[model samples]
Structure formats: structure tokens, C-alpha cells
Target: MHTNLSSLNAAIAGKTEAEALAVLADLFPGEVVFSTSLGYEDQVITDLIYLNNINVKVFTLDTGRLFNETYLTLQKTNNRYDTKIQVYYPQTAAVEQLVSEKGPLSFYDSLENRKECCFIRKVEPLNRALKGAKIWVTGIRAEQSGNRQDMPQLEWDEAHQLFKFHPILHWSFDKVKEYVKVNNVPYNPLHDRGFVSIGCGPCTRAIREGEDFRAGRWWWEDESKKECGLHAK
Candidate 1:
């Protein structure tokens, strides 16, 4: 709950991804953590952490509703990096209660139901993953969504009680793909099939060309209500 954003920002100022991660490791030590979705940008950060040997705990949420390709990429990444990225699963009791009470496809019925499902499967587990961490690193890029455009590269997340860092906040989609290709980072194959932002298997779809990056996610909902509460400030 104690972070001097200015001093930490100055420490990482003008540093490469590896250097910035090293700085965070020095600042927070074993308390630094990163959550990866096995996407293009996350893969780049994974490479930076593993290749540079940064002491950061990496984890991913298994929502019990993910694409096969995502799992494949997760395995490939583990193989490539020779590391076992920790996996956090939703609490079984909560998931059982939700499904038993509302049925399996209740999320498609209304926004409230969708949010509840997301809370059970993602937000709650994310809170558990972030517990006792001083730094919560992510691969959020500003160009990915309108809501994220105004977010700083590093900022305090009051809800999570941690300093959130976006290492490639200013990177473009092409640049992310370039880094992945050049570094040989393992990424979800769904990206090549037009799935710009991959998420739950039932909730995500491929977007047509000229569409917003987030359009593929929660496509049934209005654009303003697309967030799943995991990234909601």
C-alpha cells in the first residue's frame, strides 16, 4: 500500500523492457508479479522477463473457459522458457454456486449475469493471484481500447492495492507482432485468425477487418459495457 510513484517512475525512465523489469525487481524484489494472457504483447513481456532472468512471479488465470489455442501457447511458452507459469483457477464452490443457480449460459441473458460470471471466474481469482504483491505488471497497450487510452504506463490501482505497470503501453499492434516474431515468443495462434483480443472461449470471436481491437470480445454487449471487471479501475 506504500509506493512512491514518482521515484519508481524515475528509476524506470527511458529504460528498455528488460532494464525496467530489473528495476522493478530491485524495487519490489519477490513482490513483483506479472499476469499473462498468452497474447502477443504478453509474450513479449514474458520473453523480457525470462531472457533477462528478472525475478518476477508470472501467473495466468484459467477461467475454465479458454480456447484450445491459448492452452497450446501456454505449453509452448513453458517449453520455450523452461519455466512453469503459475496457474490460478477460480474457486470451485463459487463457480458451482453460480452455475447451479443461474445455469451455464446465463451470461448471455443480461449484463448483470455476465458480470457475475466474470466476477466468479476472473476477478475473484485475480484478487487471489495479486495478494501480497507490490507490483502488478500487465501487457495493456493504449491502442487496444478506448478506455485504456488515458491510462499511464505506471499507476496506482486502488482496488487491488498495488502499483500496476504496463511495459508496452505505447506499442502498436505491428510492433508487438514484430517483437514476437523477432524474439520467437510463443503466442496464441488465434491472433493470426483475426482474434485480436482473446479471452473466454464462449465470449470471444474473430473480428472482421477495420474493426476495433476489442470488438471481438463480448460482441453481444454494447461497446461501452465490454469490460469484464478484471481491468476496470
Candidate 2:
């Protein structure tokens, strides 16, 4: 069951990430999971989990279109932490059907077509990865998007019917970067090259200085259609 954000925040207030992890360790007491995309925020959370020796499971969706740098970071994370990071892939039939019908570049045509691609490649697989989990941990920060600005540090994910926790929800991009640098955590190299929001290869690009943080993702579509449905309400 999802608890109210205020109550959850009060419970975790004044606690460090390590303290929070200890509380989560006792709260769930079994099989807590954290999903990552090898982004800066995710890397910071990954480092916290690793350094604190938290028993939470860390995993990622390998949408089959990730950047080479993302793949390398995944490899490096595994090598450095000496812990297994599970990789989830989309179902073969769903992927084949979308590609076969849309020719893999259908997102260039219309919003519906792009959403169709995202549904098959990301949303569906994420649903599977989250199944049966009591808590869903993410690297979501309020400043990341307008829609996310109102998000709380912890809330019930009514969409997924689980408690959703955002340890760094109030953190700034600079703070996330600082933590990553200070901790020497492994992150995607593309971040340094201007990819603020990384996703699949065809849909993601580098953003300009004045562009929106998410402009690089689905650059062919309007702002409202930027989401891939995983974060949709």
C-alpha cells in the first residue's frame, strides 16, 4: 500500500541515505529493488547502495538501443562493485512486431508511431521488471521536468500499485554531479558530451546550451509527448 508523501517524508526526515537504506532494509526486510539507467542520478543512488552495502537489487532495462557509453558504464559498474546488475530486455515478439510494422524509424512519422515504439521497447519491459515488488526506487528529481516538479520524495505509485521512493528528489543536477564526482561513481560518458536525458539511440540526441533538459529525447516530437509512458500517470 502507498503511504502519504508527507507522512513518509516525516518518517525519513533528517536521515542520511545510509540511514534511509537501513530503514528500508528493515521495512521491506527482503528483496527491495532499485532500477537504474546509468544516468548521473542513478549512478549516485547506485553508489549509495553499494557503499552502504545495502541488500537492494539493482537492475536496468537494456532497450537494445542504448548508447555504447551506457553499455560500457554498465560493464564498469559491474566490474567495480563486484555485484550483479540485472539487465531486462523487451519481449522478442513485441519488439519484432513493432519494428516489422514500423520499420524501426517510424517515430519520424507521428506521435502515435513514436509512442508505439516506446510502448514495445520500454514501457512493457518496465512493467515486467516491476512486478511483485513492494517498493520501486528511482532516480527521479523534481527539477528534471515540469510534470515532476510537484513530485514528492516518496509517494505511492498509483499507476504501479506500489510505494515509490525518490531519495534524491530535491537534489539539483549540480548536487548529483558533485556526489558522483566525490564518490567516483561510474556514469554514462554521454553526459559529458551533452546528452542530458539519455534514452534509446535513435530517439536521443545532444541538447544545446539553452535547450530544455529533455529536448534531446524524442527531438522530433512536441514537448508533451516526450515521455515514453514508463513515467506516465
Candidate 3:
């Protein structure tokens, strides 16, 4: 489907999260999909879609390296909403080959190795999850990373061949947390202990008091190389 980014943004302008999601679901029906990582922002989106009963398919990529808390949050969300959020996983053969050839922890050796692992675990599965979708919704916030600062609320993703929308793109961290709290959404408990970004457990950690929002992810790498290719340009 051909989408005009400017017109799409204008259509959802100033609408509440649920309202905007309802509009998208009505417009695309089964063609709109939302990907969540069980983070705070994602919990808010889950609430918007599930609680409001929007006609959007929700799914998560299970990389097998996720935190225990993430799994628990996923379970809690499913029970609370009475919805089964679909799961997409990396192909078994690709994962076997990568681990067999490079060994676990090879991602620490170089940026190339890291991106390769991410491609096997995240990017590839993301492509599968996004198949046949006309729109891909995400929980990205501009303030979370410099890479996303220039992203608009609506944009065409050439790699995925769909329009990607960030419902809370301009929202603040505090605003997201407050929404989660007020809505009684289930979120990863790691956020309470300084883990600003929750990805695969091995590559993620809690940040210090004055650290950047994304510092907790791939902490050893240069700040510019931290993205895992799932959201890269």
C-alpha cells in the first residue's frame, strides 16, 4: 500500500494514544502490527491496543537471551489483558550456525560480530514479524537515543517495506512512566533498578545516575555503534 507520511501524521495529530491506534486499526484492519519489547513505553502501547480492543496484531521477538523479568512481564500482560501476544523467533538453523561458528559472547569481540548476532536474533525475526504488514508500530521515544532524534512520528521504512509509526515518539521518559503507573500496565521490573533500555540480557545492564538513556545497552561499544540494526538506518 502507498502511504503518504505527511497525511498520516496529520490524521493522527493531537489524538490520544488509544484514539490514534483506533484510527490506524480501522484504516488497516489486520495489516497494522505492533512490536513490543515489554519495556515501559511498550507497556503503554500494549495498554492502548489491548485495553482499547484495537484491531492490531501485537507480537514480540524472543531472542532467547532476554531477562527473566521480561518473560514475567509478558505473562502478566497476557493475563491482565486476556490477549495472546504472538511471538516471533529466530530461525533455529541460523542461530545454531552462529553459535557453533563464533561461540557465545563473540559479540563482545567486535562490532561486526555483534551486528551479526543481532541480525540472527533480532533483525531477522523482526522481518518475519513484519511480513505482509502495511504499518509497523513501535515504542521508540526520541529522547532515548540520538539516532532516533531526527525521526518523525510517521516515516516509511524501506527495509521493511512499510510505514513505521511511533505513537509516543515525542513523549518524555517521565510521561511514559507516569502513564504506565496511572494505567496499571505491566512493565519489566529492571527499569526500577536503573535499566533504562531492556534488550537481550547478556548485552544489557543498568546505567549510572548521570549516564545517557541508552548507555545501559551494549555498554562497551562506542555510543554511535550501539543500535542493533533493528532500528538502524
Clash pairs (backbone) in predicted model 1: none
- Tens-digit lDDT string for candidate 1 (143-195): 88877889999998989888999999999999999999987788899998999
Cα TM-score per model: 0.97, 0.94, 0.96
State each model's CA lDDT, in order.
0.92, 0.84, 0.90
Order of the predicted models by TM-score, top scorer first: 1, 3, 2
Candidates arranged by lDDT, highest first: 1, 3, 2
Point out the worst 10-residue segment of candidate 2 by lDDT.
1-10
- Of candidate 1, the 10-residue stretch with the lowest lDDT total is 1-10
List all candidate RMSDs to the true structure: 1.4, 1.8, 1.4
* Top lDDT hit: 1
Per-residue error (Å), model 2, residue 183: 1.3
Candidate 3, poorest ten consecutive residues by summed lDDT: 1-10
After superposition, the stretches of candidate 3 with alpha carbons farther than 4 Å from their true spots are none
Clash pairs for candidate 3: none
Off by over 4 Å in 2: 1-7
